[model samples]
Target: MNIKSLLLGSAAALAVVSGAQAADAIVAAEPEPVEYVRVCDAYGTGYFYIPGTETCLKIEGYIRFQVDVGPDESGPSSWDAFTRGQVQFTAKSDTEYGPLTGVIVLQANADNATFQDTILDSAYLDIAGFRAGLFYSWWDDGLSGETDDIGSPVTLHNSIRYQYESGDFYAGISVDELEDSPFYNGETPNNVGVAVGLGGKAGAFSYQVTAGYDTDNEAGAVRAMGTVAVGPGTFGLAAVWASDPGAYYNAAEWAIAAEYAIQATDKLKITPGAQWYGNYGVVNGATDADFGSDDAWKVGLTVDYQITDNFYAKATVNYLDGDDIDDVTTGYFRLQRAF
Candidate 1:
């Protein structure tokens, strides 16, 4: 071949090679695929599947502002304002036995001037109707309004429980550690309590009976409650009897409460309730002289208004009267937003 032809051939080959190299450099690699969060409807609404796991997670919370006007420790009566925020995390997974769930709730409160301490309100696990960990006492379950107090003091406890539910019938039993319970008086004994509850619904009527025994005091209390639908509202009745006063159950010997929740509108509810206490204020086997009252009664009205899907307001006014004590009136207003 001629030298000029050879040189032209070499240049053409070099240009071809360089062009191929440039084309290869300009070509980009494919991007990695993204994993998006998937909605989990297996449990309920507002739940999403946890990434890279079969578990489902749900986060919910509420912010509340409250104004209270009532008796205080140092003052006869005072008005106080407080704000509270709460967050709850829930995780659930299906298992061979049943659905396993874990919940954690954190709460913080602040007054108008000072910030209160944060608290872990609840931490618990449930599997196959079996539950354990720190939770509210089952005895505190009652009607929707605050007026349906059957004298059972509401508190939290570390407990283990098993519940069986079928259709409209349910039963549960629990063993609680009551060492740090507020119901204890001076010296506590066994510091343990047992609780059992049974309930069923038939047609428009539902009834529940619960009993709690304090091993330390060798005393127990029994509570029976029932509700029936009437027209556009519901009527509820509850009765409680305790062997010992203020011993993990009723604060008095016996108490009865009645409440009627009236649906004023689609977004408004009004509940009027009344409670009667026999041998009121008797605690730790104290006589009437200690409390200066043998009987007491309370009447209250609660109003709830739902402003939106996740916003609501509540107001409650209560009047308490005793045989030998001054009549007192208390009330509170609360605004809340939930998510």
Candidate 2:
């Protein structure tokens, strides 16, 4: 009888201890999985998908240092040396209609003794070949060398543009917003510019012709350029005609420019170019007496060298002569690193 009673007491104590241990035990829940960044090659290199989104983003930019020297020592004809850095972000994704893309570019610069404010250089959206926002217009396209001034008075503008491409044939049109002049009178109305271009390539030859009109000034400009591959070089010809002094092509009433860029070596190119202008000093208008109707001409040599995969150096020297102004020498040396 005593042995039976002792066994019952030990069993009750063990059961109580087991219940206590069960109550004190802690349970841990599993953790959520992590999402990783993925490479997106559908667009191009250096693009990756956002951790939780379908969109892909690419970041790229370039840093450039340039020294510009001109004849005069003071005023507008003085020299300018500057360092500039730019960063660009491009986001892209596929949609029902087509590929949707957005781009933003920021730039900072130090010119001469002044540190300029950082600015938004370009921001635009493109979808199905339609583009909008602030960007370089189609008129900014020029020859391969820097010896030619072949763009609007203000090359950058808030614009809406559409482009279409088929094989080697392409075309584009733009409506650009023009900024008010510093001499704006309260009665001066707002202004806008319109431009259109058509281009094509055939074997060793390619050409583009573009026209622009300034609504405020009631003036228009037309430009045509062509390039052909010849032996180890490319020969380019460009001509521009303007009805009067306007925003798009005021460098001259009419101008003719030409250049032959020779690939002297795998890493070096040499280009000698020339330009002749009719009524070059008529930049402002018939009202601005400072710029006369004198003719001008320029000849220049440009050199480009690739130092490394992402580094390049360029230099150009030009001599200018006009009926009203004395002969002058001007050029610039630039180094750029791009990624």
Candidate 3:
């Protein structure tokens, strides 16, 4: 063969080999597919299914800015401002027993440039009709307005409860660890309490009855409340009776409250409420001399305005009077946004 022919043949072979290598490199392997989060409408809004899991998760909460005027039993502050934020997490799944759910809430408050400690507002689990956890006491049933204090103290404690529900009828019973409860009076031998509640609604009328028994003091309190729709508003009436006064009802032997919530407009609500306390000033089985007054009453008005879908503003003014105590007035304004 001639020298030129030999060189041409060698170059052609080299080109063929390089072309094959380039073709192999251009052919890439297929990639794995990706999974995305899916929305879960089974429970409610703002819920989504966890990737690759049947469990559904939801997160919700609110932020509140409040301004208060007047003096409380705590101290004499002409005005005070505070901001509070809360977040809640919920997880739900279906099980053989029924729908199982868990919830956790965290809260923080800041007042006058001082930040308070964070709080676990609520943590609980529910399956079927059984629940257990740290939560508010069952005695918390009352009207919407803050002035309607049905003599039930607001506090949280560890508890286990079983509840039954059918349509608008429901009943529940709970046992609480009352050692750290706000109702615990000094040196109580017993540190447990039991509570039961029954509630139902028929048409535009609804009623609820709740009772709590303190094992240590061998005393209890009973509260009954009813509401009915009348004209452009709803009227509510509630009464409470306690055997140990402040230990259970956070009031005297007996107390009564009435409120009327008027839907003045689509975005505005006005509620006027009144409460009367009889045989006032008994706390933890002991009667204080300052509570010498046998009767005390309070009248208050609340106005709530919905600024937007998730924003609201509320204002409340209250007047308090008693047989021996000086007349006092208090009020607060609050703005809140929720998700």
Best by TM-score: 3
Report the poorest 10 consecutive residues by lDDT, candidate 3: 284-293
For each candidate, the alpha-carbon lDDT, in order, equals: 0.84, 0.85, 0.84
Off by over 4 Å in 1: 1-29, 73-77, 183-185, 283-293
Per-residue lDDT of candidate 1, residues 213-330 (tens digit): 8776566889999999998899999999887754466556788999999998999999999998887775444322122248989999999999999999999999999886789888
TM-score of every model versus the real structure: 0.88, 0.88, 0.90
lDDT of 2 at 303: 98
| Residue lDDT tens for model 2, 261-310 | 99999999999999998878554433442234789899999999999999
Candidate 2: the clashing residue pairs are: none
Residue 288 lDDT, candidate 3, scale 0-100: 29
lDDT of candidate 3 at residue 227, scale 0 to 100 = 95
Model 2 segments more than 4 A misplaced: 1-20, 24-32, 72-79, 112-114, 180-189, 283-292
- The alpha-carbon deviation from the true structure for residue 73 of candidate 2, after best TM-score superposition, in angstroms, is 6.6
lDDT of 3 at 220: 84
